[model samples]
Structures are given as structure tokens and as C-alpha cells.
Target: MTTNAELAARFEEFADLLEADDVEYKPRAYRRAAENILAHPSPIADQLEAGNEEAVENIDGVGDAISSKIVEYVETGEIEELEELREDLPVDMAALTRVEGVGPKTVGSLYRELEIQDLDDLEAAAEAGEIQAVKGFGPKTEQNILENVEFARTIGQRQLLGEARPLADDVLEYLESVDAITETEVAGSIRRWRETIGDVDALAAADSGADAIEAFLEWESIDDEIESGPEKASVRVGDVRVDLRVVVPEEFGSALQYFTGSKDHNVRLRNYAIERDMKLNEYGAFDVSDVDDPDAGQRVGERVAGETEAEMYEALGLPWIPPELREDRGEIDAAAAGELPDLITQGDIRGDLHTHTEWSDGNNTIEEMVEAAAERGYDYYAIADHAEGPGVVGGMGLSDTEILEQVEAIREVDAAADIEVLAGIEANIDADGEIGLGDEVIDALDVIVASPHSALDQDSAAAADRLVRAIENPAVDVIGHPSGRLLNEREGLAIDASALGAAAAEHDTALEVNSNLRRLDLWGSAVQAALEEGAIIAINTDAHQPATLEYVRWGVHTARRGWAEPADVINAWDLEELRNFLH
Candidate 1:
């Protein structure tokens, strides 16, 4: 199968080539194709094998040449043209282009003239006084490259959503404090609530665009300034790239709607506008048919202005699309059919079904966790600390005997506090599908969450069987982090989710959308499949610490991606219904 990453990398390489050649339209076309391909829901190889070239061409901005490139790359391991281009250029193209202000043309020039192949080689040449001797290379250019190389290596990968959210909030607050900035919105994947974020993008409507850009560049929190132009400024803040674009108030909503995109969603929306003899872009929408000239028409190119996101959607004859559901899944269809789901809100969740306390590995005690839940207006919560045996070690989890004692202890805290705290245990599902805690202890707890903590290397078929059996256990109320994947660091167990979801539904068990940003497993597809099989989803934060309870937002957003409505989630029920299901 052709991984999306591979296709994206190729598109970027193509973009690099087009830029080096100084071809305007080709570069934008490739970049747009890359964006659409990355946002596609299914694997490109599956579409190709099914003989659906339309799937490739259906993407917005993919032209014939770009589609052919994708087909050739999938059939072979490499793109022939990219390979030829690489051979023509002596530089380590990827590495050279990473330097700030150095694009592919600069790389090509440096490689042909100075013979720089890698970051280290470039640095050595710059130090040896060879790069400055070249015609187009100046002392400033060489100096910048030498300084940025080490920073690039130490900058680390992009920030995960868990790390970026607070930073984005802080940025928005800072921007709002500035008098010149009138409106602000965080755009890009962070806005889309993607699991991982490469950058934090903010678009602002300002009274004075130039002043706003200058103010953003001078912000104290910015760790490093990457680029600052008249309308935009890019900075690096604690391993996350933050880009801010300043626009006029008149163009604010239109720009926000365009920039806050799952590119695929915007493409579809744009195509919808085109079908209706209208046009949409970052500036605004325009009525094409109203213009006299189809080719040389100015009104067709003119902005169909909007001052709010609702106006943008309204012009398109639909309701506003939430940023979280901007990914091109079925959102368009839902919007067209007027069947958009009433997404589960934070307030809709009446209880926190899975949490930890000092009884296991959690930082807070039972009373503290319950009080925090109460502070958040939750009517009920479950203290699901770890249970002993199998994956449990270092006395981090309670023994079977200790679990019964803790249940009584939980009741005491629940009675004292104003909130109801159900006794629960996060029991381990061993290799053989058996939970670590005995049935007697499990039966005593108000909620039993069975999770896989070991043997993650099992074959896919075996992994699927293990999960199915665990969910089938009458005492198991929830399956925790179905795939157990850790973003960027690890790929967890793979299971046939459809089979597992069916089993869970048959057994009256609920599947959890583990809200730990690091592990958003039961991903969107799994959630959708689970819902299709009539399985209820529990959006649990699986909070080990007080601050982590906020992660439920990401989980709920993830559920929206899976097409889960308020009714599809078990935790969205009242306290009594949730308790009944646990029993």
C-alpha cells in the first residue's frame, strides 16, 4: 500500500523542483495536491487497486501530471522524474532545504557551485570560506545557514496536540491583548483537533496589518524568529512552529473559513461553490455567472465577502461546520442532508468513568479526583485505579483483596464529597484474554475497564481475538485504548475492529475513546465501525492527573470524526443510565 506519508514526501519533492525551476502554477498545483492527499480518509493504494483513478483525481487541485505521478510512484517505489531531479542536483536536497530562507533553488545553486551535500558539509564549507566565494551566495546567506543547522537538529519534531493546546490558548490571549488585533483564530491541524500538530497557525483581523505583523514578531514568548514578511510572521516556540497572518477586518471571516481547513473539506466546499456558479477562496466567495466575461471576468474573481464564519456557510446554503469536524469525512454529506450530528459536548458528559488516584499510579487522592470532577460539574465519576498482577509491578496496582477494601474506601469518599464516585479498577487484559483481577473482585467494583498492558507484539489476528474475548467478559464494562497506540513513539496492537465492535455490542460492553492525547485509539474509523455495529462509545479521559481531565475535549473531537452523535456515546447518558450499563 502507498502510505500517505510517502505520497506527501513525493509531492513536497516535486514542489521543491518546481520552485527551483521558478514555475509558479506547477508549484501551487503540487502543493495543493499534497495537501489533499494527506487529508484523504482511505489509503491511496486501496483506491488504486479498486481501479478508481477518480479517487486520485477527485482531490481538489490534482491535475493530470500530478495524478500520473501518484500512479507511477505507487506502481514503483520511486517517482522517475523526482529521481532524475535528485541525480541532477548534488545537494542532499531534503537536508539543504531545511535551513531557514534556503529553498530548492538556493540548494541547487549551492550544490552545483560549492558541492555541499549535507548539513555538516554545508557548515564546513561555510566555515572554510568557500560558500561566500560563490556568485549568488553572500556572507549573510552563508551565516544564516551555518547558524540554523544546529538549531534544526536540536529543534525536535512537531509538538503533539497535548503540548500545543495550552500554547495556542496563550498565543490567542496575547494576540487579543494587543489593541491592533481585532479578531483571532487558531488555524491548521491544531484547529482541526488532529492528534499531532506540526505547527500552530493563527490568522488575525487587524486594524493595521503591518503593525500587527511587527507586534507578532516582537512577542516575548517567541523562541526564535523564522520569517517575517509584511502580512505574515513565522516563529518557533518550544519546538512548535507558530505562523500568524494579518488581514483586514473585511476579509477576516472569509480568510478564517479558508485557512481553518482540512484542505479536503475546503476543496469540496469550493467545488460546491463552483457547481452553483460561484467561487470561493481565502479572500471571499464570488458569483461567477453574474459576471459577463467567463475568462476575463473581474466579478468572478471579486470577493463575495463575509464578516463571520456563519456567513461563509450561509452563502453556500448550509450551516456552519465546526472546526473539529472540518476533516472531509462525511461532514459535507451531513451538511447537505441537514443531518449534522449534535456532537457530544463537555457538558453532555455527566460522569467521568475512568480516572486514577493515589491508590494506584495517579498523583491525586480519591477525594481530590472526586472534588475535581465536581468542580467540572460532573454528577458522577469512577476511580478506576490499576488492579494487581500481570502488567502491574512496584505496588502500583492493588491486589485482589486490596481492591475490595478500596471499593469501600471509595464509598466513604463519595459520601463525604458532594459528588458520586463509583468504585472501579483498570484491570489488565493478559495475553490469553484473561483479566488480572478475579471475577469476585471485578464483580465487586461498580465499573470494570479491561485494557491490554502487555504482549503488544502479537499477530494481528491474535490481537483481535484477545480484544473480542476481553469485551465478551460479562464483568468487563469498558475496553480501554483499543489499539494502545502512542502517538509518534509507538504503534500499538492491531485488531480487527469490526469484529471486536460486534462482539462488544453483543455482550453489552462499551468501547472507550481513550482521551489521553498520546493514545486516541479507537481512532475515527474504529469509532465509526463501533457505532455502526450498535456499540456505545465512552469518551473517557483516562486521567492519571488532574490536568489530564481536560484531554476529554480531544477525545470528544475524535469521536466527532467517527460520526458519533450524543446518543451514540454511553457516557453522554445520565448518571442512572451509565450505572445501569455498568451493572
Candidate 2:
């Protein structure tokens, strides 16, 4: 039983292997096919298994060859060509690529030059100063490899939310068809929307727990059954492990509340309940204010609440806290005081202020990208492609003349386009905290997103000052990917969020929580800090293609974790108000 995710992973591995082998054009093709397969509404392998090869091939990026491979893998459990590729390279592709500056080509080069097959081999060579001696390699490259080896070594302990979440959605969709289950919801850190998750946790309410577990175990996507009981089971799905728990319909609310915890929040909540002579547990809330004997059992008191999550919270005289805010970060007190901010939702974002096009390094044309935004029902869209500066390598950033030209093209599109269009530029902030854009270019653009592409290794103090300087510039409207961090990939930079947020507020500059899965910069705590300082947040995807516009979901969740409200997000405003704020 092949799952969409498992099939997608196979192609991703194929893409990497081909890239490592320096096969031209085919790598990108395979990667695109993989992305499409992963995003497909149903399982391609299932279609293939059912003798629907045409249906599998009809997928956007899947072609004859790729579909044939899908058919081969589905029928026989292996793609012979891929196994051969593995034998040829014989390197740990995933682990090696985890190192900061290393990619498939570099892995190929290292493997060919120094026989480095894995992180251990790479580490040993770097430590022994063997990498520096290889042709086309230098001491700096060797040192960088050494520095990132340990981080690379710890590659697969957690799964990316972007990857794990879709699989969770698939699981939920499958369980919805179970007749025995009355209610179903995800639990644990996944429900809280952590950037990285240890495993996927799902909860179900059912009259018969045995029936629910039986249905779960029969899931076609499950690769291995780790364990199972009458009401609970754990299974492996691709690289992620999923744990499912089923409880009686009556106890579902309490069980969900207890499981969807940050431990600290639950402890704090339990203490608060104890102070009121109430006992809280997964069973239900109990009023134990009066008991003649102290030796009574756990359920010895009157059950006051637990039928639903809201009721559970009401029993303790508190509002229902959003899962993202259940980190025990003053949310309990905020709920009690009736002062919890209404967090921003995905629908609140009206436009994308920071995005890319073919004018720079983006994959799509301006017209294609604009059409995608219009389809998403956005009121406005800004084409803020790159402006030439440091760290924007291989002539990826546009020149001043080209930017002005793109501005006119954008205006032309705006004339007949369904949405308001703004000509913008993502200008680079150099090490000295200066924007390299000329006055003419700045005046011509409708918006400016100044970002630090270089000097991402700056310490906290330097990073804070550098960003603050950029924020204070009157021409700058936003600071993009403030910390420059790439989750599970690169450390990027260290900045003082308090200092950054304060300066951004004073100067009316918005700080970006880049929606790209890898870099959710200005993450939860940092976004919270910035919000506390009265700074605006822009959850931009920084999308290079139309499909990536969906990254806004990740940004929205990250913002909610930080307690961001619609009022605190500039793009969440109407066009008129957004213009006022930009101005």
C-alpha cells in the first residue's frame, strides 16, 4: 500500500541522486514531479495499482517516464533504476546535504575528491585538513564543513511541520470515513504548530475503541505497526511516526485537552484548578471542595465539566486558549483576565508584499505569478523582486534600470489586473547597514523590503543594530526574514527581538515572518516580542513561484503562536489602510 508521501519521497531521493550525478535538466524535472505528486489530491500509486496509469500521468508534473516508474514501484515495491543510482553514489544524500553550504553537487565533488561518503567521513577529512588539499577547495571551505558537521549529524530526529502537516491532513481525511469515530482531531506539538515535530499525534472519539483501532491499523499508507491496543496504536508513515489514540465519546474533550499540552501549560492549569478545590485530569473536571475522607479515589468528586473543550476551560473559569498559545507564556493569565488578543488567521492576509518573479531568481513570469495571486482572491499583490547587491549571487538580483523597467511592466499589469499591483524591490542591506538602492530607484518603487542576505552570522548585538538601522531608513517599509534562520538547516543569525521590535515600531517598519517552510524568521517568541513592542508583522511567502504562495499558512500559524492579531499585521489590513501604513 503506497502512500502519496512515500511515493513523493522516492522521487525526491531520485532527484537528489541525479543532481549528485550532475545529470542536467532531469533533476529539476524529477523534483517538480515529486512536488506535484506530494500535492496531488489522491495517491498516484493507488491509481497505478488500479491500472490507471493514464490518471497518474495526468498529474501536472508527472510525465510518461515518471509515471512508468510509479507503476514499476507500485507493482514490484522497487524502482530498479533508483537502486542502481544508490549503488553508484553510495553516499548518505540526506545527511550530507544537511550541512549548511553543501548541496548535491558539492556532495558529488567531495565524494569524488576525498571519498567522503557521509558526515563522519566528511568530518574526519575536514579535521585532518584533507578537504583543504582537494583541488578547488580552500581552508575556509574546510572550516565551514567542520563547523556544520555536528548539526548535519543531527539531521532526522524531528520532521519539518511543512512535511508532517500534510501527512497529518491525509490521516485525518482517512479517519473521517470511519463510521465508529464521532470526532477526530490532531493533538500534541503538531496541533500547536511547532516548526519541527517529534511525531504526529491524532485523537479520535468513538463508541467502540476496538473498531477505531482496527480501521487505523488497516490504513494503506502505514508502513509498519509499532504497537497497538484496544484504543491506541502507533505506526510508521514514511519517515514520520504517528500515534493514534481513541477514547469514548464522553471523554474525548478531556482527553484532547490533556494530550494537546505543552506540559508546562497543563501543570499551571492543574495548579490553578487545585487552588479552586477542583481536580483536573483527562477524565473530567471534579469539584472536590468537600470530602469527609481524604482517601477517596480519583473520581470521588462530582464531575462538573468535560463534554467539550470549551466546557473544560469554562469549568476552570477561563476562556478556550488557542493551541499555539498554550506554551504557558502568560496565555493562562491573559485568558483569565479576558485580555487575550484575537490572533490573525489565514483569511486575514489580504496581499503579499514580498515576492519574486522571473525578473530575478523566481521561477514564474510576472503575469503567471499575478494570475495566481488573483486566483487566491487577494486585493493587492506586490512584485518585490531582488535588487542587485552582496550575497545575491550569479547575477540573480536586477539592476536599477531593470527594476524601473519591471515597475512599468507591473503598472501595465495593474491596469487590467483584478487586484491592485505595487512595484517593489527587495533591496539588500550590506554589512554597514546601508541599502544600496539609488534614490531614483527608491522613488520609483511603491514598496521596499530591505533584507540582509549577507552577514547572516552576525552576533546578537551586531545583528540587532544592523536590522534597526535598516528599519529606521525612511524608504524601507519592511525587514524581511529578520533573523535569516533556516529551520533544521542553518542558524542564519542572532538578533535581539526586543530591540528590533522597538525600532520597527518607532519607525513604522514591519518585520517579516518569512512563510517559506525553511525560514520562519521572527519565529514564535520573536514575533511575540515584536508584537509586544507594537511593531507590525508581514507574513510574506517570499514566493518565487505561484505554488509557494501557500507558504502563508505556515507564517500565519507562526504568528498565532506569537499572539499576532489582525491589527498587528500590515498585510491583514484593507488596501487603503495598508497604503497608509506603508506611506
Candidate 3:
């Protein structure tokens, strides 16, 4: 009943939990198996149902033990081996490890030494002076655990992109302002434009390591210092930890490429490099002519490093892949064939399709929003604030009458404004997957992006049905943030994306790759699935404010990761074609 990807994800979660418990090589084995399972096209369950359990052995990196476990899981809907492992060290292991300074080994040690089973137990132990009594843990370590426990409880798991982006920018600006810093760029999930962030990673290419490290520690924006070292430094800015790594200029680009990764993407790229007879590392890639020779490529006769990203890619016979397209979702082949998607660039966006003014929770007025769009060289802008419905409460949504009044106001603004103004509404997708706006109201709008804001708890089957029904609505021009996810904060609706994509194609509805960094809802995997289903994506910035309009960069990045080319994006079409699609 489960898909290969789901099986892999479950196994990966178990592996992460096991890793946090310091369970040793078995954790690595599980993680490796998870990786192989994710890429396997055939459903392991289906294969098992068809009585081909040995098919698991065909998966690379899945050895006998893992294959047996998969057979057990597929047969009985459970893995006895995993259950036994959980029983041995049964605790809130995942939660315990989620703290800032806590990892698997630390969690294991604390459990063994202090008998701390959960967050509350660990907190009690930390307060009762039991933790500092452990050999490796000292006064500082105890303080860190206690401080982080409070933070962990207050902040939950990950920070939203809206909160994390500004912090990364602030840190980068501060680092750049310092005299010791030569150059700096944000790397990690933030740079990759992942919808959520666990930590903000920054890599600085500096001449003096000591000076850069010192400058980083003294940054006023840093609320608390976590760790400071020669190559790397970590500090807690509010709830988020900002990590900075200093690299020599020679390997800066390579380091940037390595550090800016979705771990799976990096693994595939690494394998690709190895297959090409090269080796990639934090330092620039090496020829690795002789694997037995540790210093073979760095020897006197060989070139040791790539000074730029292009050279690094060239070493592997790959054209330089963009950071956003580094998800390995098909970009490798696209890059190899020189058919990389010409994704929508920021300059190509002539106007914002959906935005709010003071009429909603927006920070600016409609006129101000338009002026900002004009500043970005936009020829037209649409004011598409929320319409009253299931998700909109506390005066956040406009009533039907108010929506009509706003349309007239938009017409008035259009007459006086230099750029054309269109009236639009972010209509609500009701409980039964129908837009609340009637045909008359829908006809009055230039465009309507119907979105599911509530009832996100619908099961996968029901969610798919709901979305399919909504996509069939003739008034729906775009399905906003198709999944409704807010990164790590919210899982959003569970729908069969491939099915949804096919339905959208049939209905001629554009799926919005919402530019909000927190809600890059159509994830890279979903985007790839959608494109394969021939679904058109509109890379729109559901801009609530002018400053936030720049989030299109994040949307573009997400689309590129999905291997989407300009042709795949409805917004990438010319204005005439776009208008025709809207109508």
C-alpha cells in the first residue's frame, strides 16, 4: 500500500532517530538503505506482494540484513528488528536529540550515564546536578543543555524562512562590514531556499582565519555564542543558530557548492564525480588518478584545486548546475545534455498576480504595492487580497461586498496609474473543494487563485479528492501553494501530487510555485512529478508586501530544483499567452 518514497522516508526517520541514540553502524546501514529505496521506482510493498522479496537485494547499498528487514516490514507491516532496537533504548530519543547542542552520541551518553529518558527527564537531570557529574559534560555543557532545553520547548523545531532569512542577511552584512572578512556567502538550506531552516550556515573566504573567527564572535547581532573555532563558529541569534565557516579563497567556490546542499543531492553529485574518476570534497575536487595515493592529485605535477564553480563542474564533464537545481531530481542529465530549463528569472516577472494591501494583513497600501512593482519594472500589477472564508478569520479576509468595492477601487487606481491594475482575489477553497465565490464574482475578477487554507488535516486520499475537485473549477486560474505546507512548521495537505498534476493539466489550471520562502509548497520532488504529468507551474510571488516580492528568487530556485524549464512555467510565457491562459 505504501510507495517506495514513503518506505524510504520512514526508514530514514528511524535512521535519524537511531543516530540520535548513538546506535552505531546499524544507523548508517538504515540510512544507506533509505537512500537506495527512495530512488527505486518500483514500490517495495508491491514487489513484496508479488512475492519477489529478493528484489530488495537488487537495490544498491541494501545488503542482506536490510533486505530481510524490508521483507519483514512488507509482509507484516512492521520490522521486528527495528521494534527491538526501539525497545532497547525506548525514550523520546528524537526529541532529545533535536536540542541545539544534542546529537546521537550525546543523547546515548546522557541516557546511559544519567538515565535521562526524555526532555523533561533530561531537564530534571540537568537541574539536579547529575549531568555535570558525567565525565565529558562539564559546567558549561550543563548550562548549554539547560539553556537549550528552554529554547527547544519554546521555539519547537525549525524556524520559518521569513524569520531565518533576515537573520542570515543580518549576519552576512555584519561579517562583510568587518575589516577581516574578505568575502562571504550564505550556504546551506537558506541558500538552497529550502522552505524551512534548522540553522543558518555562512561560508566566508577570508585571508586571516583568526581575524575572521574573532570578528564573527564579536558580531553584535549574535545573541549568544555557541561555539568558536578556527574554521567554524556558531552563535545563537534568538532561536536560530547561525554557523560560519572560513575557507581559503582557492576552495571557496567548491566549499560553497559542498556546504550549500540537500544532503541527498550532494551524495548523488559525489557519486557522479566518483564515476567520472574524480573525487569531490569540501576543498576543490581532485583528479584521483591513483586512489591508493593519498596525495596523488595534490602532488607537484598535478593541479590540486578548482578556483571557480564552473571549473569544478567541468572537472566532472558537467556544466555548472545552479544551486537551486542541485536537488539531483533530473538536473544532472539536463546539465549533461545542455538542456537545463531556462527557469523564470526575476527580470521576466512583469507583475505580481496576488498581493494584499492595507485591506488585509499587508504592510503597504495597494498604490504602494503597485509603485514597488513599477520600481521592479513591472508593467501591470493585480491586487488579490483574501476573500472571507474558512481560513480567513479576525478581519484578515474581505467580505463579498467589500471585494466588489475593492474591484471598483482597483478600476479607479487603473485610470490614474501609469501601469495597468487588475482586480483579483485569493478565493477560498471550501471544505468540499469548491471556491466560495460564485460565477458572477469569479467573472468580475481578472484572475482567481483558489487555495485551501483550512481543513489541511484531510487524509491523503481525501486530500487528493478535494484538490482534484477544486482543480476542475473553471474559475480557478491557479492553485496557490498546492500543498499549503509551511516548510517544517506544517506538513500541509497530503495529496498524490502526480494525480493532482494530471488533473491540473486536464483542467488547464496553473499550479502556483508560491514564492513565500516559508511555503515553497510545491517541493522539488512534487515539481518534478508535476512536470512529468505535464502540469504547468506559475512561479508567482504571493507577495503580501513589496519587500517580500523578492521571494520570487526562492520560487525560481525551487522550480529549478524540480528541473523545470521556462516552457514548464506558465508565467514564463509571454504576456499575451499568460493573459490568454488567465482568461
Candidate 4:
């Protein structure tokens, strides 16, 4: 089946190919269609299969031309125009675009000028000092290409949580429908809410393993069966691989604990069990010291605990740890001492501080965004549209005059709404640590989310200093996506987070944990460091559409991984308390 993700990738590549050829307008249209298709709730293949061509065409930003291509790909597994474009520009667009400063145009230029085809060819040209000889290219550009090509080469193949979670849910639902399956869960990194997942691991408790495996193999979404047996099966669903394992009811707890792991965490647990003259494995926890052949069989010992995950932990004399805290980053010690912080939950959040509207590259209007927040039961919502400056292109950022004009527009929306609307701007933080907007414009807003949009390759000291200066600004309320990193793509700024956190605490500024799966900046470790320094966290979705507001859960879980409490997050406060903080 042609999945929505696969279709989106094809359209994105098509856009790149067009851009490389210097074709204007159509490339942007294709990219917009691709973004909406990727974010669409239902699979495009399903709609096409159901003969809903009109529905596919009606998708936001998709038109007759793009929808026809989608239908063609769905029916024939190929798009004629895309194939023609590929033939014309037979270069690896994805690989070339991975470099920091390289774009589709750059790839086209390099290929035309030096016949560079892939990363290796590009590297050879850079090493041979030939890229600088191309028109519009210089020595610095060649050096940058050389430095980033290696990082791009090592980029791991992993699926984002936003994409993986839905497929996991589908598999879990299908397995649960089997009469023989008693309990089922998604384990591995998916259970831990890792930003990127290598594969999906689903576990089941069943009386007859054969029955469970049969049900799994018959799933509607399974594209290819990799392997199968009575107890286990592996299948490819779309582009993701899923492994299914079934165990008896007695061993479900142990299996879950073992499989839902960071390798380091499991190793520590196993060593801890050894010191107490016990053994721990996927089968169960057992008293090994009393058995002559503890390893003789899978369950060959005096079993201590295996019925529940809490029992497994109790056998080790520790509290039941949350899966998010299973990263072996002092979580064991914290659990043993009963000092683990009370983590924030979905119900704790009362408002959103970062969002966009049609005024600045967002699809929805300001009124639509405000109403969406009200529907979510939020007490307040801030409209932090992009402010014009560096890295702001395609007329996607607001001028100072335009931003001031939005104040009244926001007020008009707030007048008939249940929630308070806070007019704000996402100001760009220049390399010199100055905000793009003037102080008067900054002072006029209800909230200011200062962010670094350019100069993302600074060294550690420079990055830390740049962020600290932003934190020290009295007009700034939150430092949005502090590191500017994109998971599995660009390695944004490398900063000393501890130093930056202390400065944020000193200046009463909050650091944002950007909730977009692609950019979960101020990630787990950074959030932890900031919390330790008494800095506040604001988990914002950075939402551009109504559906994206649900992403706050991702940020909340990421925060829980860092030991954040409801009190530590500003958005979790009540309206009065939030107002006090803002004031």
C-alpha cells in the first residue's frame, strides 16, 4: 500500500527537483501539498482505495494537479512527472540537502558544474578543492560542505514518535481483538517515548501463542512478512518494521521490563540483581544463589517476582520506576531513596504560549487558532507569530507595524471568546544576541518568545553566551527551542546547558521545550539540567494548526523524562498564577 508518508516523501522530492531546475511557484505549491499530506489524519491510500478522489483533492493546500498525481501513484505505484524529473536530475536530493548550507539549487549547481552525484562525489570534490571553482561557490562553502557531509552520512535511520505511535496503536488494537490474547502493550523505545524509534516492539500475553501469531500476520496493514513462528513474528508495515512476541501470562511482566529498556538501564538492573545473589531476565527474577543450575532452564530457580512490573522492581528493593525514567541517568538512586520528583501530567497544562496563524505561514486564521485553544479548555493562548529578520523568508515573518496591528485583531477575537488572548511574537535572536524587533515593539507585546533562527553552528562557549544574553533580556519571557536542533537531521547549537539554565533562573526567564517531534529542543538532558538550576520550563507545541495542539503530550512526556513537576512548568499554572508570572 502507498502510505501517506511515502506519498509525502515523493512530493517533497518532486518539489526539490523543481527547485533545482529554478522552477518557481510550482515548487512551493508542491512543498505545501506535501506538508499537509504528511499531517493529514487519515491515510491517503485508504481514501483513494475508497474512490474518494474529491476528498483527496479537498485536502488543505492540495489541488487538482497534485491530487491527480497522488491518485496515479496510488494506482500504479509511480508518478510519470516525478519519474521524468528524477531522470533529468539523477542526483541524491535527500543526501545532498542534508548538508548544512546545501539546498536543491546548490545540488543542481554542483551536479551541473562538477558531475557530483552523491555524498561520496561531493566529498571528493570538496577534498580535491574543486567545489570552490564553481560559479557562486567559494572556499568557505566548500569547507562547510566537507565538515557536514560526515555528520549527514552517519545520520541514523529512525522513525519519529509522531509517525511511529499511530502504527503501534493500530497493531496493538488488532492484537487485542484476538480471543486468545489476554494482555498487550507497545514496548521498547516507543513505550519510553523516545524522539526517534528504530523499530516497533509489541508484546502479548496469551494462552495459545499460535493464535496470537496468526492474528498478527493477518493484519490489514502488513505489507511483507519478514519471519514467522508460533511464538513470534516480524512484519513490515509501510516503511516501519514491527516485531511481535507472545509469552505466557506468568512472564508478561518480566518480558515487558526487559524489552522496554535503554541498554544501559537494563545492564545496571542486572548488576544490581547479581549483588543480591539473584538473577534477572525476561523470564522472571529468581533467587539464583540457592540453585545449583540457575541457568539450566529459562525459569529454573525460586521465582521471586514475575506477575507485575512493580513486583519485578520490588524484588530489587526499589520503587516501580516510570518508563520515561528508565534511562539509567540516576533514576535508580532516586527510586531507591524515594526521592523521585512528581512528574507533570497532561491535565496539568492550562495554556499554550507559542502558536501561529495565517498571518505568518500558518494555515489557520487567528480567530480559528484562538477558538481551537478555547476548545482545549485553555485559560489563555499566546499568538507568537514569526518576526521578520534573518532566516525569515518568503514573507513568512511579521513586520513591527504588522505585529502592532495584530494587537487589536487579537482583542477582537478575545472579546467574544472564553479565553484570554495574549498577543506575542517569536523574535529572532541574531548572532550578536540582539532581538530583531525594536524594544518598543517588544515592550508592547503580552509575551516574547526569543529564539535563535540563524548562526546555529556556533561553538559551545559562543552558543551558551548567545542564549544567556537572550535570557537576561527583561522583555523576553521564554527562550523558544533553546538549541534549535532537529532530531536525526541538523545538530543545532552545542551549548553548555547548565550555564544557560542558571542564567535563565537568575533572570526569571522560561526555556521552552518545543513539542514538535522534529524539534524536541531542550531535550530530556537539557530539561533536566535546567530544572536542577531552578529554571522554569514551558512545554509549548509551537503549534501551527488545530490538530498539532495535541502534541503537548509529547512535550509533557519529554519533560517527565527530565523529572519536571507541575510546579516547574509555567503553562501548568492557573490563570491568576500565570498572570502573576507574566507580570
Best by TM-score: 4
TM-score of each: 0.71, 0.93, 0.69, 0.96
**Clashing residue pairs, candidate 2?**
none
Compose the digit string of candidate 2's lDDT tens values, residues 204-235: 99999999999999988898999999989999
The TM-score that candidate 4 achieves is 0.96
Q: After superposition, how far is residue 259 of candidate 4 from its true place, in Å?
A: 0.7
Question: Model 3: per-residue lDDT, tens digit, 71-182?
Answer: 8776676777667766776767656765656766787788778777788998998888888899888888888788768655654666666546766777788888989877
User: What's the alpha carbon RMSD for model 1?
Assistant: 19.0
521-562 in candidate 1: lDDT tens per residue? 888777887887888889999886665687788888888778
Candidate 1 TM-score versus the reference: 0.71
Clash number for model 3? 1
lDDT of each: 0.79, 0.87, 0.76, 0.88
RMSD of 4: 1.8
| Higher-scoring candidate on TM-score, 3 or 4 | 4
User: How displaced is residue 216 in candidate 3, in Å?
Assistant: 2.9
Which regions of candidate 1 fall more than 4 Å away from where they truly are?
Answer: 1-156, 291-302, 393-395
Worst 10 residues of 1 by lDDT: 151-160
